[model samples]
Target chain A: MTVSTALPAVPVTAALPDKKNRRGNRKNSTLATVLLLLGAVYCLFPVLWVLIASTKSSGELFSTFTLAPSTHLFDNIGDLFAYRNGLYWRWMANTALYAGVGAAVSTLVSAMSGFALAKYDFPGKRFVFNVILAGVLVPGVILAIPQYLLLAKVGLTNTYWSVLLPSMISPYGIYLSRIFAAATVPTEVLEAARIDGAGDWRTFGRVVLPMMKSGLVTVFLFQFVAIWNNFMLPYIMLGDDHLYPLTVGLSGLLNQGANQPSMYITVVTGALISIIPLVALFLGLQRYWRVDLGAGAVKA
Target chain B: MTAVTALPTETRTPRTATRRGRRAGAPYSFLAPALILFVAFFAAPIGYAAYLSLRRVKVSGLGLGAGARTEVWAGMSNYARSLTDPDFLPSVYRIGAYGLIVVPTMLGLALLMALLLDAGRTRVGTFSRTAIFLPYAVPAVVGSLLWGFLYLPRVSPFTDVVQMFGVEPPDVLTGSWVLWAVANIAVWGGTGFNMIVIYTALRAIPTDLFEAARLDGASDKQIAWRIKIPIVLPSLIMTFVFSLIATLQVFAEPMTLKPLSNTISSTWTPLMKVYRDAFVRNDIYSAAATSVVIAVATFAVSFGFLKLVGNRAFNQED
Candidate 1:
């Protein structure tokens, strides 16, 4: 199993003679730059609008100039926080717990299963991998209703475990983990650890995991974002507002906005706050998102 | 290679046999948690859904007593009802239109941006890339909420700009325009991630592969069309499949826009219908049947797509 570990090559176009191609190249570059900047503006428009809009009082939200800044940002946040004795903050905490703990456990599970699949020669390995791959295509809607029913039978519905347990087994994570294990953790190190009288578990814990650290970080981040962004599973499983994630909580708040127009301001403010952690995480860990869909397809 | 080389030296030792035996069992132990979770969460739910889809409650004598409501085999009645229901087909058609609008436009923009970014000719590439990708960090619910407000004429800058031209801005959340409005939210939230995926694939292409085209005096557009696109076709196919799957399950965005817009019904999408049935109306059997139909359709579409594409994108080695 060969892994493509080639570093990105510097573009040959960069070294082209500027004197001759300058006219054509500059024209093309300007067009590309303008197009790209337009795209950037289109994407950033909403986020900027939200930031400016959240600062307005409820009365000003519809009446004021669309882009005008106001002094009611803290007031809106205060109303959001003060709603129903701080239910919004509880949703925030629930989101953190679900994404944080769920991703951590999912990463560990994927790492272990992936290492085993990559390293070990065993009966039914192909069958195991194939089954898990099939799980990837199964729609979540097919599972969510039944999962809720089954969990209801067990009295686990509307609980934290209802959301977290279903999130642990991600076939995509295991698949990526397998690739990372094969690419990063060499067979020699495992053999050396075994020869040095270390147990398999210890060797895996001490050697294999650290070697797959960056890859595992990628896995963790993907799962973290997935759990954080997930609305269907949690929305189906948990009924209690106290246990709702930001997605469910905000949607519910918006539902109430029909009667009370003031809830729209709170909803907007909550939306602004809800996106900060993830956008920050995404920006900080920009380099870790090395997604190559063709990697497995072209090679495997 | 080291394992094979070390095999000759280790085979003579009796301890090596036991070690190999233990190693054979190690993978199963390692895989146990995932397997257990898979069965409990994925396999069990799917099986239970299928089972429940084939059965229904038989309520006798005005449905007054617990004993009168007996569980009985329903066969295909639920499926028959679901397929013939007025709401089900329209939801499917709505999503079909939604997918048609979303998948092409989003992927086209994604491909265009990816090619432009990979061309390395753009100024503010980093800023555009980050900014475009920022929407992905926002959840669908939040993204929809933001866009829902933006669609409101009273609060919309687009409306404000149009009014300056002595023209009225059409209500985006009404009529056929609402479809475009909903589609725009999806396109906005999705284009960045797909762009990054395609961009990553583009970056992986060896520069030498394209240097020859450059030497031949081929234009950037020609090289992008001729060389770069074919190389990333597999990634494109992959993103298409994922995007199609996501498109079929459009719920949150439309659901979020519901309060703001009366145009969106309770059954705006098939998944939404399933949600309405299972939770809202307490019709789990029909919901299960509809979900089964959805699951089967998803499998058929994905598998059929792969097969139609000659299965080149996912030819796993044994």
Candidate 2:
């Protein structure tokens, strides 16, 4: 009870500190700021390096000082575009289709299943929920090979369905949606909707879906990043280069960097481009990021 | 639907019975899509993997005919092979060591950063928070690539600084140092997200609780250690368990760095070994057994942590 009331009083109490004690707080804050900025620097160093490094030409990438920026960003991007008949752009598009569409459908499915589990009283609800809870703990990448073999048997291995299908059902998404539904969607409102002669599907679409929109967006972002960052699943499943996502395709470029040092620019350049979309998403939707590790059981 | 409507007439009111009948099948219909996908992708694959684990390709009659080799039940032999393989134990040991370094160090840093942010006295809190959390967006492969180049002698800015001072930079991507190098990448990528979780939990603590502590003259450090730590223990523990599971299955970082260094191999970690076995070596039976072992171990560790923590954080909502 105290915790519930305490949540609302947080910002008000934080801003109510008296002026007399502010002097003592200033000293400690300086040290805290320095320590935090140090962490910030460590985290931002690589990102900064990528920004500067992407500007170098292939010859300048190795010859010049590593952090020094050269005026070749446009040329490198142009080269990346022209490489292999614009393969890099195909990878970018493939990643968008995988993460964007995959996350959208997964969020809808999770919303439906989570709404059912939370709002409805059914016979096997506990069993269904427990199975999903256990699925949340299962190391998903462990199933990659088995899924590959099974898909191979069904002749679905080399197709987009192989990646999109497995990516659609996120146990973690369903789990979060359940929590959001129970917390935000009131039983009384649901009963009122039913009393108005609304069917199950209609109530869900009209009432529950709007209430769960923000939470569903959170679910979408989570699954989007999960699918986007995924390397092993698509790495193992997709055999064709044209069908590969950015992570897999870029890693392939890195592997080629071992023999041809010239390819290092492309790998670095590709790595730079791949992260821009994610960094933009992260910065833009910063508020929607609520990570409950217990939901996903594992996130990377 | 029939079952709900056919309940004993004397035992139920007509209105309640009719309502139950209307709502009886709705939940299942809504759950149908998820359940179908789960069975097809989750349960079926697990069951098939278990089936393959206990089977092996049997070769007979000089293996010369059209049906020279056939898959047959091998009982526990595949499990024995996976367990007894020379690569298995070392991979497990390496990952165990890596987890020890990662889980504590990462969580400790996360806790410290969260406490500092919660202190709220600093002007840099919001900037530091966003900057630190930015790496969570970068994929592990990209993070590894960026760090791998930074570890290189020719391309490292740190190397440039060291050479100016007439000293050689320590080899970070070779020998035993490579473990820490890989561990560093994981820490760099993970610390920010965990920090955000712990920080969010900290923000939920009512400031009035700390007002009394401050009146009693508690220092910031003292307040953090005594008050905030206990309050956010559940989030800390949850993050720790999740990190342990993730660290055990470390794949992308090592795989990404393999092109740059010789220290990493096909079996640098258990998951990497599973990938190598199933794909590179074409040993599906052994790979399935190894994967099952890893999966069971992950479940046991995660649930064991939950049990130790009394399972309150997850179930308390219910």
Candidate 3:
């Protein structure tokens, strides 16, 4: 790994020469490239289909070829906006609000709790850590029904708080933040801050947080994507269409496709539009996408 | 708190002891939010689900007014009903089949892709990696919708391609093929993320370790089979476990595809059965019992698999 990193821009294939049988090596390498490209095509086909499908009108959607692009992109967008007096835009905004606000608050809470678990010694710490770890394995889908029932008892169902409140408590976020805090924030610096008459909160907010900036961004992106992509929780929690996130909203539109054939185009358009933000986030934050599952990040 | 930090440590007094007490309290104070949320959302829900599973609604005389139907203890009747429901066992079997198809295929493809990318010979590694991972950014609902359109006869370019060769396209959304259809959706969305994980692990292995194998006249496939696969077995095991968990809880893809396919029942999977029992059939008690059953099964499968495997992947004792 170090050798490959040092020789940047030199392809790894260039180093595989055996000083004999060059043609056979070239053929094998070409085969590998073709096989990889085929895999790429398989993965990108659906995304490409959605991109082209969203450009077609209701009539052209069934009438024209699947891959052919039409000039109805703006018309489809206009129709999606005009449907139910701009309800699609509302779903988009609701999704952004849920992911943005939920992730922000979740990140802060996880940072605090994870910092405590990583840096400080207290009674029952191991118990708390083990329970949170168990929470990580608790399949979140199983909790949806019970959470809905409990929230309904308190008259909190079908409300934004039903989704946002639960979204703010991500066990995986805390686990990642704990690893990040343990890795990035040094104990010597923390002790120095404490010796300089800084309180715990002040030291954490001013010093520890800055060191954990990249990891916290990773945590925020992860929770944001999870909440954004979530369907079952919001589907069970919110009864009203106006409160629906993109997943629930688009699914409802797809469900309506059995009766209303035109909704197929709308669902396609909504799916295409909904994925733009996530794909953009992925491309822009490519470096922070590293999730070291083998505990290497902490051990580093 | 700052004042306590400023106090002199030379004099071991009660004030110092109080500062030590405050230090002990700091971690608890910091953990207050997570602990509260965990208790409310995690622990409370599981407990309430168990309680609801053990109880049922008992209707009184006439069963008309607000107080007519009261909640009462039902012992194990709800669990008995849920376990005996004809839909329940089939749903479990369907999920078992789906997991068998999905977990191995997805992880195998993921492992293959990771090994190919790690082989360091493919020219399109970066492009293919991003393209394959692009689906992870798309939501399952949206991904299913896209694939659902592709499965349709009128909208599928695949059908056109097959027809161009004078062959009929197989109906992918039919009863016989719906499992594979849903499994494909899972594989499409899951493979990229797992590939990245395995690829990250593969990258962590030093190139020098494999350089010696190459110098010994071993081919790329031989090197990957002998050296790379064994070194990344832990990562593969971890991915397999996670894929198993996710496969068992598949709800979104099948739910999204139900609008298109007649084969998918309202209770297609165990989680979906829980959904229908709770929301569609208005049987929250039975649903609670079924969810508990599914949760227990999941934990058993996961922990049992780990215990059987001797926990070599996650041996972090420290």
Which has the higher DockQ value, candidate number 1 or candidate number 2?
Answer: 1
In model 1, the clashing pairs are none
Task: Mark the 10 consecutive residues where model 2 chain B has the least summed lDDT.
Answer: B1-10
lDDT of 3 by residue, A46-155 (tens): 98888898899899998899899998898888888998999999999999999999999999999999888888866697888878877877888888888888889999
Residues B1-318 of candidate 2 have per-residue lDDT tens digits of: 122223345544566457667778988998999999999899999999999999999999998888999999999999999999999999999998898888888888888898887777776666777888889999999999999988888888888898899998988889899899999999999999999888777766677888799889998889888888888788887888778878878899999999999999899999999999999999999999998999889999998988987866665544
Find the 10 residues in a row with the least total lDDT in model 1 chain B: B1-10
lDDT of 1 by residue, A177-268 (tens): 88778878888778777767666788889999999988898899989998999998999998889999999999999999899998989999
Ten contiguous residues minimizing lDDT sum, candidate 2 chain A: A1-10
The best candidate by TM-score is 1
RMSD of every prediction = 3.8, 4.5, 4.4
Clashing pairs in 3: A1-B207
Worst 10 residues of 3 chain B by lDDT: B1-10
Residues A1-300 of candidate 2: C-alpha lDDT, one tens digit per residue: 222222221122333331222223554467888899999999999999988988998888877998899998998888899989999999999999999999999999999999888877778988999899889888889888899999999999989999999999999899888887876788767766666667778989999999998778889998999999998999999999999999889888999999999888888888899999999888777766655444322111
Which has the better DockQ: candidate 1, or candidate 3?
1
Give me candidate 1's TM-score against the actual structure.
Answer: 0.94
lDDT of 3 by residue, B1-318 (tens): 122233456654565456566677788888999898888889999999999999999999999999999999999999999999999899889999999899989898888887877775655776777778889999999999999989988888878899999999888999779999999999999999999878777777776888788879899889889998888777777787778888889999999999999999998999989998898889999999999999888878887877787766542433
DockQ of candidate 2 against the true complex: 0.45
Model 3, C-alpha of B313: deviation from truth (Å)? 4.8
TM-score of the first chain alone, every candidate: 0.90, 0.89, 0.89
Model 1 residue A40 distance off true place after TM-score fit, in angstroms: 0.7
